[model samples]
Target: MIAQTLSQLRQLKLTGMASALQTQQEQPGPYEGLSFAERLQLLVDQENQERQQRKQERLIRTAQFKLKAHAQGIDYQHPRGLQQSQMAALLQCDWIRKAQNLLLTGPCGSGKTYLACALGHQACLKEYSVRYVRLSRLILALTQAKADGSYGKLLKNLASFDLLIIDDWGLEPLKAATRNDLMEIMDDRHDQSATAILSQLPTDQWYQSIGDNTLADAILDRLMHNAHRINLKGESMRKKLNSLTQAEHLG
Candidate 1:
């Protein structure tokens, strides 16, 4: 019943709004059947809680996709959504289960970040812990920690998320110190925890983009040495959205 209601709500595109509250307000009674007031209280308790959970899920997914959109400079529809088949094997089918990383690369709007976040989401759904952060913000945070004598404190927390995402790699050149911080995280995650990286630059061009040969080499050696690489190929999602809007206008 829960699944059916969720499906119906999603189909009507009302999952993100407050209009569906009424439908969920009076949940079906249990096997023992309750009095009118009990049922009403149950509705208030169950429906409201479920609605909030759905809302939280939407927010989490939106945050994840937004990171991808920013990374690719495109919208969520870019890559036209990750076909379940493309990732079916990685999460469900269980392709090599090691501490290896997953790298997604493609042109702007190709869904690099979306794929990365989706993979992370899948991992969490499968009971693996996850953390999402943009590459630029990560660097900035590391820089601040270094200045305020809290580098270890920050890294200790980072070491915990079962799946860590380093999104939008190569958005800007990495300084020597920032490059080291990136390397440390990659090194620590190597054979220790899972990592997913989303980037516009291809693997071969990463060295040039990172601006540190030795550090880049170390990062790749640890991250790519045992990684699953997914290369997305498609037109820009922004262009596609624009075409759809134009079509609607013309129609």
Candidate 2:
């Protein structure tokens, strides 16, 4: 009867429950004393746990994060201006639910991208969809999408993600077409979805990079509205890591 039940569970795609039941049969000493209701509850709990794990894996896989980072991996020990309390609040993902934004700014190699990716990983763990794209590549892709006549479709797809991470922001000047495309993307997400912008340039210089008075104001207005800002200040994390590696080799 147990074998038949296991077969039926496999057929029904309750693999977690099936596996748990098999374990119960193989090692019945622990479960033998339990009531039928208690055993059934165990099976259900196992299935729920397996489902949650699968969902988290799927979210992380689809995120396409640049770094294998997580909330726990953040370096608070460094003097990077990162507040643990602030990060704790952000990790709760309330800002994402409220369709707010996050701005990460620092000098090159100061771990802005790493911190952004870490937060993004936390969002995925909470089952939120995420996408990481460099600003220049995003602009190039948007231009190609326009030529291929999928611009609107692409915009819709971009707007649907729970969190959109734009890295290397303000790296170069934006032309008229690029500015318009950015406006479209930002307008679609404004008050509808969350965005994370990682940049080496300070927030104040973002205006100069945009180069168009009217469009820059419009873009920054949408992006900065209710945005949480993190300005990391420290020696380059990359350089520090490289130095440590060299020291280890010498030792």
- Strongest candidate by lDDT: 2
Q: Rate the local accuracy (lDDT) of all candidates.
A: 0.68, 0.92
Per-residue CA lDDT of model 2 for 213-249, tens digit only, reads 9999999999997899999898888887777565688
RMSD of each: 9.2, 1.7
Show where candidate 2 strays beyond 4 Å.
Answer: 244-251
Candidate 2 shows a clash count of: 0
Native-vs-model 1 lDDT?
0.68
Supply candidate 1's per-residue lDDT for 222: 86
Residue 197, model 1, lDDT? 83
- lDDT tens digits, residue span 58-110, model 1: 54563343443222332434454454555666765143245667878888877
How many Å off is the CA of 154 in candidate 1?
A: 1.1
TM-score of each model, paired residue for residue: 0.67, 0.94
